[model samples]
Target: MPSNVPTFTDLLAGAKRSAVHLEMRDTYYSNPRFESWRQGHCVDWNDRASWWRPFHQEIADAVARGVTVRRARVVSEPVTEYIRWEHYVTHANVTAGEQVRWLPRRLASDLLLPGNDFWVFDDTSVEIHHFSGDGDSIEDEILSDPKLIELCASGFERIWERAIPHEQYEIH
Candidate 1:
């Protein structure tokens, strides 16, 4: 990303309508949060202030403004350890005012999904994240192309429609 490129926080903070994220990876080790998850077994879901902090605070602020923040994940059955870890920590996401859902890969087979993970903000701008085979984020790029934005928005909705809400999905 260039110096002028806006951060994900900046994108969310600027959203005037809905902000949606689609995650396709089953394992992510690049986040240091995973380290804590690995050692502690779970995120401190009850410690609202200490646990979520500014990141969740940012999403809360957006929700306060009526920006419907949602995240949809597509994972395989017999979920990976990292995914189980994510399933456990996601309660914080719901508590912070974002809606989250999970789509089993088997259930999403026919959907024409994007090849990358992305965040589409306000149905306008899109940020695509590229990760290496090991699941480390190698690069991310922001796109203003109307076609790409529409594609991402539609793809997210397709997955969202098929996914089970966080409260309903059981980790495999």
Candidate 2:
């Protein structure tokens, strides 16, 4: 996280039409929440107060503003332990108004995807996330080049079309 680069909340708040995310990695080493889940911490879905957080509130707020927030994940199957943990907690994302989908890597073999994960905002700008080989997030680069934005935005839509909605997708 850098001072110059806008945070997710900032980007979402500024988004007018749509905010889409594409995640291709099966693991993220920097996430403490995943660590908690690995240690046996489970989200009590019945109790909203237990798992709800500011991030969800951001998505809810953005959706309330008519922003179509969607996330599509391209995972390898038999999924990694981290992907299983991600699946366990995806309800929060759905509850927050994000339309989530999953596409197995095997099913995406024919598609040309982006080299990095990204968030395309309003089809005008893109936030490309960079990660280390060990799955630790390194930095994010925001680009507004028309060609690059178009490429990423279109790439996301292609994956979205092939991905199964979270409600229907069963972890393998």
Please report, as a residue range, the 10-residue window in candidate 2 with the lowest summed lDDT. 1-10
Clash count (model 2, backbone only) = 0
> What C-alpha lDDT values do all the predictions have?
0.90, 0.93
lDDT of 2 by residue, 1-172 (tens): 6688787778999999899999999988747788888899888899999899999999999999999999999999999999999998999999999999999999999988889999999998899999999898888888889999999998999999999999999999
Which candidate achieves the best lDDT against the true structure?
Answer: 2
Error of 1 at 16 (Å): 0.8
- Between which residue pairs do clashes occur in model 2? none
CA RMSD for every model? Answer: 1.4, 1.3
Model 1 TM: 0.94
